[model samples]
Target: MRGSFRRYTRWFIAWASLVALGGWLLPPLVNVERYRRRLKSELEQELGRPVDFGAVSVRLLPRPGFSIQNAAIGEAPGFGDEPFARIERIECDVRWRSLWQSRLSFDRLRLEHASFNLVRRPEGGWNLASLIGREAPARGGTAAGSPPADAGGPLRLESEGARLDFKIGADKKPFAVINVAARLDLDFTRGNVNFRLAGEPIRTDMSLPTPGRVELEGEWTPGEKLSGPLAATLRTEGALLYDWIPLLTGRNPDLYGVLDLQADLRGSIYSFQFEGRGTLRQLHRSELPPPADAMPATLYARGQFDARERGRVVVESADASFRDSILHSSGNVEQVFSAPQMDLVVAVEHSRLEDFFQLARRFASGAGAAGLSGRLDGLVTVRGPWREPRLGGFFKAQQPRFIAGGTTFPMSDLDLRVNETGIRLAPVRVMVAPRVELVAEAVFRPPAPPTMRSKQISAPSPPSAGEPHAFGLRGLQYDLALSAKAVPVSDLVRFSRSLGIRAAREVDAQGIATASFGLTGKVWPITPPAWHGQAELRGTRLFLPGLTEPLHLPHARLEISENRIVVDPVTAVIGTSVFTGRLEHQGGRSVPWTFNAHTSQLSLEQSALWFDVLGHRPPLPLLARIPGIRSLLEQRTAASSLFAGLNASGRFSVATLTYPSVTLTNVVASAAVSGRTVQLGVESFRAGGGRGAGDIRVDLTAS
Candidate 1:
């Protein structure tokens, strides 16, 4: 029995050896060429495109493996006329376990130098939908999909380790070009897949006509179904200021700056969070642009967005800082974003008004001094879509002061509101004097027909001297309602001086004086035309510096008509005397004004008082000669009053005050109407210059 068993074992060993030798020397019965053709056909059927393969080699090393050199796949149907992927070489591992998997399975698949194109349609769809359709079941239902009788087989899969070159955009009119040279590592596990790609500092060149170049570097790992974090950082250098300046002023701008940003992103489709910080430096105007001013040397901002739920995004926080040539501002903003609505709150500290004026100068519209400084607080709410944004906000400033056009004014407690129509400010308080306040309500809107042109009509017949009636008028018509209250008359004079109007200063005998009026007219550009209004003055004393002690007036009202200002029933006390006057604007470019003043019982002492108030004192020698002047001098008085109980009406034309070439048109003293001149006669005719008479005529059209 032992001998027989040995013989059988020996025969088995010999047979196995013979089989192995036959397998090795019998041309390796894999039919590699035939298999390659079969694989080519299968791939073509699966991809719906032609497949090309070269130099198929079969191997029997550690396991049965095959290599295909120079493999290429044609582009899918809607992809135009180019191959989809081209691989220099690919090696696949095939074994009994892989073959029994009921499908072509590979233990390992390696590829090199592969290229791909990604396209997006204008309607927001992609071309890769066909790739996902390939994995669906071939048969109908559970009964027909019954597991195969011999389903116990190893899972079949293939992974690639290749370098991919990718291009992005539509098939035609491609805009973005991205070149990626990376180590692509992918793994296909049972019911799950993991991929990791790392590239060496990818550079992107965008031709968007902006300022600079963009560069990026990062690694990405996409797990099954995009359930992982994706992050990247892109930087830009040499950004232009003009690219962003228009955002501030609603005008085209030219400027340059260096911009850099770093952003990080995390979360999935259900939620997302993005945080970033950026900076700009060396900002300046590109050229002679509208806001032809340079920006601050450096600007910086940091912000974050958080979306942990649907329908809402929260601006966790944001802060910005700027310091331009003449202005400086630093602030923070917090906002909430709902699909169709948005709300934000902003607060700024240490802001200067002068800087704002300088900015306005570029547009040829600025006020007061050029510099301003103060603190500001603001709140804004915005809703609706971007196409038609609705904006409303409130702004307030503390101790805001500015000097523009040569005047200095302090703004206290300024509150304003903005809407689509225009901006409105109520009770804007301006300090015109140490103890006086000017409160006003102002509205500014785009110039319309009524506001831009004056409406003028023929004037009605003039009323009698004592008749009280409204005047008729004609010409361009404008609606300008400005009411200034509780402002001292002296302050008004000072304010006028700041407006390039230099004239004799007016003194205030009363503690405070107030003038209130409304002016409406169609003023031609830089030219004054026919305007009508009513002005009321209330005060105890109206000081005309060139005359003497303040002229005491109980109250005064003026009726303004086209080319005329009528002061009716005017009563003023000047050293026990009363005077009245009517002034008129002689039509011309120089604003020539003529006045007819009548007075009764003027005293020398009163005249001296008026002259002193006019910012001048009587000459010492003259003071010594006149008895009245001497009496005032003995009392340390600086002025002498004129005493003459007389009714006189004099017409004088003062076209220009700087050089003051005065003209007396007519004078009637005590029933004597002098022609073309006024002659002043003292109580006695002994005074020098023979009554001081002169004839004069004013040429309003003189250059």
Candidate 2:
């Protein structure tokens, strides 16, 4: 038995050596180049294009394969003379048994350094349509009820360094892909194909960004018509997304970031569904200044598309997060007509407003958003079949606080709602101090037609035609009401200053002031705003800087309008004196004012309010250094348009008056001021039953 085994081993070794030698030496003896023209003709017929090559080599052993070097496939008509496809090298292997049967059945194909240009012609037909055959029934149809054609055996395909170019007419498309390495297993007998592809994204225009990697895997049926019930997954990562945005969206976007994305889908050409997730890290914008704080964000989505129905897309679910804050949404859009129809719903809960600001700070112009801290909850719904979308929603903030210019306002429980006609805020309350509260409510409507334009129409008319009143806020027209409860004067003054109301910041006051105000107007400052309001200030005990005793105003009624303010019958008590006045101010480029005041009884030493406006000093000069006094001095010195630029006139009557060492009865005075000059007349005065009158004038052009 040993001798027989040794003899068999020697025979096997000799046969293997002979086969190896034949595989290496047969190609040179056979003149394989002679068959190149024939092979090229066959390929041209199959590909529907002219084919050319540099060299062709045949291998007899090792499973019977051939190598073609430097092959090119010509383009279709009107697509220029450049080759549509080119390959540095290609190898194909066939089964030995197939060769024995005199059949040319390929088992495997490999391509290296291959490039293919896929183009869509100007008339909207693809260049490769001929190779794909007609989608309609063939001319010589098979008999009805005949068995299906037999699909060929499996073919393994491998490609390395492959590139695909997309073109419209003669111009390269914006986006392309290169450096593709792929592996495909096609089972024709089973009508199934499985493939893995990976590549780098490229831009046809060299100026565009080319900084991303993509990978994909899929399984599908490859029938004569290539109908699909396919499944696929894709992944991509990019370091600078803005560079590539123009290629995809044709817009120069301002965003910059590192982004990673992944998606999975299962469907067909007629209908499809997909889910995707993405992360954006180190995100910022080139146009915005660097943020003091920034955070990464994540987004998730799932959707379906139906090509049979106008290619509508329905987003079944979507979730996005900034830090711990999250927003969930769903929507559908269909372009079935010239105008699209859409419906969407968005809900946000447990979202941290501070974290959201961190993401929004780049777009906030480096203003007040960074100083906000709170949580938000909201629900929004939008529906549209007509031109204007209808919107309904509400957003509420809990324990929100914002700091600006070194002052903090704790705004609490703000609810903003949108209805059919306008946006509404029921009431938003803020704590101005330890025991002070400010509450406000508003309803903002859509913009109204210009009065002058609307006046030309005789009858009441609808809004201008062809101008759509779309959803969201267009131009803000609002009605507002505000009230304060037990607010301290000092705290209120500070709060008013923060709101750009500097006039109230310099008054020295004590105790609490209760106030109410209302306004109706458009919000844009460039347009004249309508104003209608009545504000009442009831001071428990208000003090002036140069006064020894505090004053009390029991009633002060003010009426406000777009161009005027009127204060009538104001009554105040200072020491034992009583005073009343009516003051009217007209708003214009130059303010014009009139005052008619009467005093039933007055004590000169107790009326500090009158003396305070003159930059007067109290008995103690140190009082001038107080906050209210200093602020008043600063404001007075800073004002370039004071009484000098004002047009004002006033008349006063006093029943009885007491000065430092004199007493007067039934005194009357009148004053006029215009453009840096003042004129005063003492109409009548009675002292110890004697009567007297005088007039005075002063020019104040310099000071």
Candidate 3:
């Protein structure tokens, strides 16, 4: 048994030695330069396309091969002036047995830093059609790894650091799959081509911020159009929503979310079916940090894509969820590579109310998402062109409390509707204060954003990839109307302060007011709100700077506009007496308000008291620091030396005037008030029904 084993081992060694001698010595013995011409010819004949290469050098360590620099394969007819594949360097291994036959052949071809261009013609033809399955031409040549004559090589190709560019007709696209390493085995014996590829996708238009790797491995039969059966996997990691949306909208809004997806494709290349799932996190519309208690969103899809008919995609199943809130959609999308249009219906049901859904927050911002606590049930229909899509839907939330500026406003429900014209929310009710209920409604119209020609456009339902958020954040314009019951003026001020109004926080007053006002404005820095409506005042009182007594106001109609306030039929009440007049306030630094009041049957002594209350003034703040100056500057006409800064004009009638020196009956006087000075024009006076008429000007000042 030992001798039999020894004999077999010796025979094996002898056979290996002979094989080594044939493979090692013959290729070096032949002039390596002559093999370069043979290689060019073989590749041209096999591929049926022109081949070009620069210089060539031999490699004999560990393997025998040649290194060719600047190699390129010519494009098919009518494609472009550029080559189909351009390589920085090419390396191929020599078949030793073929060299022994006094001819050269390559068993393996490796390419470095190569770039491949794949073009699709308008007529639905591909540039790679001529090369996908061109059978070896009828020529006398050595098959790969064989010891025969004639120029030939195998169909095994490996490449590193390569890029695949896509083009429509002669125009190249800015998107590419780059830094790719691939291996392809074209096994004619098995009538199939097996390929494995790994690469990173790059989008130059918006400079994709967070990119990820994509890999594919599949086998195809050449004669069957390389689609006898195919399977591929697509994966995306760390993708940002802003990067994809800002390219078209020209605005980088406040979303800082990340999306990760993994998908698998199966079937022929022309008609492939796919399924994918992804996770979305950190959905926020402002620079403020995302809510700490917010949960990430998830998405899934299963669909079949047809490359024919301008690229059709029919979704079999699509689902999205944010915790307990879920949505399901399915439909078809056509013209994917051009002006895509989708007819998909997304039905959503939000079961959890606390801490709003991230998916909902992505579409609705500011007041729309504020204190959205209730269960939501709705359906959204996505349809029409990609750029000018019409979203038709109705969403309602219940059992919620709206909060703004650290105040929780009690609200029972919210309803929103979207149609082709715009987004609208009608009749939203909330309890602003204990007994005052506020009813508000608003609407916003979004202008159609321009499209990026022939670029990938994604519809935003659950915030997949689009600029719908831009129209909300930067270009939004809404008309808001608010109607309220009799709200206490203090509560109104406090509520306004809670909403971040500086003017409301600084105001001090006591009154009850009810208003029905409407305003229109753009939600941008360029425009301020324009308010127009009417308000009613009751039980109102205000202490003026020039008067010590609080000016008790009478019921009046307030007409309000952008820059002015008008109080018509102004009134004042004193113990068992009432006076009527008019008041106007122009929003300006000069004399913000002016008022005039008059009363008949007033006693001269009582009328003197009314004049004192109406014409009082306070001194300058700094001058008031002096003891005597304060009392002198802040006094009625009986004490003040400086002019009182106030103005009013009216006519009064007196029943009787009593003084220690004299008693005058039936006194009529006209007064012009100007800056703490009373210009009195006594038209006439009577002492016992005997009338005397006179026009006399008198200055009423304690000089």
Model 2 per-residue lDDT tens digits across residues 550-589: 5677767777765788888677777687678988998685
- Model number with the top lDDT: 2
Clashes of each: 44, 0, 2
Clashing pairs in 3: 644-675, 644-676
Off by over 4 Å in 1: 1-118, 121-208, 223-228, 244-258, 267-272, 281-314, 323-341, 349-368, 404-408, 418-422, 435-438, 444-482, 485-493, 496-703
What TM-score does model 1 achieve against the real structure?
A: 0.43
* Candidate 3 local lDDT, 1-703, one digit each (tens): 9999999999999998887776676655667577667878756654557889998777664688788899999998888888999999988777777678655666778999999999888776677656655444334753432223244444678999999999999888777888999998765444467788888766666655524566777777645444456777777677776564563344565466777888888887788999999998877654545666446778899999987768899999999787777779999999887778888888867655554444545434343323445677777788887655667888788776766577888885778887656667758778888867788877765534446321221111122244353233345566667777678766776677677764443333468888887675665422556676777878866433333334566687777676777878767765335667676766653443555555544444443443334443322243432221234333433233223534555565555556556666677766666654566766677876587555545454443
Q: Could you tell me the lDDT of residue 684 within candidate 3?
A: 73
Rank candidates, TM-score, best first. 3, 2, 1
- Model 1 per-residue lDDT tens digits across residues 438-465: 5555443333443534333221212133
Candidate that beats the other on TM-score, 2 or 3, i.e. the better one: 3
Candidate 2 local lDDT, residue 330: 96
Q: Candidate 3 at residue 682, lDDT?
A: 66
